[model samples]
Target: MPASDALEGIQACVFDAYGTLFDVHSAIGKHQHRLGGRADQISLLWRTKQLEYTWIRSLMGLHADFWKVTQDALDFALDRHGINDPELRADLMEAYLKLDCYPEVPEVLSMLKDGGFRLAILSNGTPAMLEAAVKNSNIEQFIEKNFSVEEVGIFKPDFRVYQIAVDGLGIRPEQIVFLSSNAWDAHGAAAFGFKVTWVNRFGQSKERLPGKPHFTIANLLELPNLLG
Candidate 1:
């Protein structure tokens, strides 16, 4: 009954790292020189399958941490996208660890932190991976914590992962505003009782999901404004 009410009393803004705070495509594109003409296709397919595997695996009750799933997805995408070099996979993954933040992210997050709202990351990434990405993107300063689901041995859409974030941070689920780039995860968080904000960077049309976001924005640039 008081669903969007989650947003009204938000105490902290927690984000999904890969697509929400970091630029996934830019990370892939950085491998363009090595990936040659297939860079874009390779990057997109890998991310696509990476997410697909997580969804299917969650549904099938098989669990893999995010890093393994990222590689498996990369393997699948490489084969389908005509890439065959083992060295290239390493290069691409190295780039993933170094993804740049969306240009607007740093400023908006700074505003949020300066305003005394808590800022944090709750990701499916390994702790090291999450840390590396955040450091590379220059987002570490604004965040108070970096939380990984790996500690709890699960990926998202499982509800338990969100609970880990809530419990680990010692915050009520309703006090945290969960920001995600993936519509499905946004749906999952909202259904699980966190405030949900969908960063619809790619202009995705809303599809039916169990629960919907309290607010949607084109980028983090608009986030601070929306929060107020």
Candidate 2:
């Protein structure tokens, strides 16, 4: 379907951080020389574990802040890959703090802001991480709010996590246009009543989840055209 079909009544725009806007793989990519051929494997494992930890922790009612979970996930990935350099682990964690936003992020966000949409980032990232990333990406001016899962102590696919955006913006669920690169995230928000767009940058398969996104776009650059 054309992206423009999803723009009808979105009063605010909420985004997912790690993969949707920022390039999460860039952290591992920065140290490809140190990781050698294992760079891609490590990056994949790190993200897989990072997300799994959140879901597992949430299900078990065991809450660890995202930063801690991020490190723990990294440790598991490094161990699995048999790359045990303490400095490299620390460097990878540090690199995450400044992941690069997608090349189209700044301009698209500026366009959305100029169009008078309330823009926010609702992610599982810790406030410190979010702040640093936003500042480093130089898109802080385009964001009106940053809603971290820390507020609710849960991760995405959970209703409360999506509720953060609703509460933070003081808008009904249907009024928000929720965007995420994760298919499950888009489904979750859709189930919660947000008009969702799954930014399928990798062209991944559809999720076997409860809800479906109203639209799908390959990149943020397609977003502004959709909004109007």
lDDT of each: 0.85, 0.92
Tens-digit lDDT track of model 2 for 133-181: 9999999999999999999898878899998889899988988899999
Give lDDT tens digits, candidate 1, residues 1-228: 444344677789999998998888876787788777877888888999998988888788788888889999999998997768888789888888898888888888889999789888988888988999988877788888888887777788779888877987788998998999999889999999998889999999996989888888888887777766
| Clash pairs (backbone) in predicted model 1 | none
RMSD of each: 2.1, 1.3
RMSD of 2: 1.3
Top-TM-score structure, candidate number: 2
Query: Residue-pair clashes per candidate, as listed?
Result: 0, 0
- Candidate 2 displacement at residue 179 in angstroms: 0.3
TM-score for candidate 2, please give it: 0.97
TM-score of every candidate? 0.93, 0.97
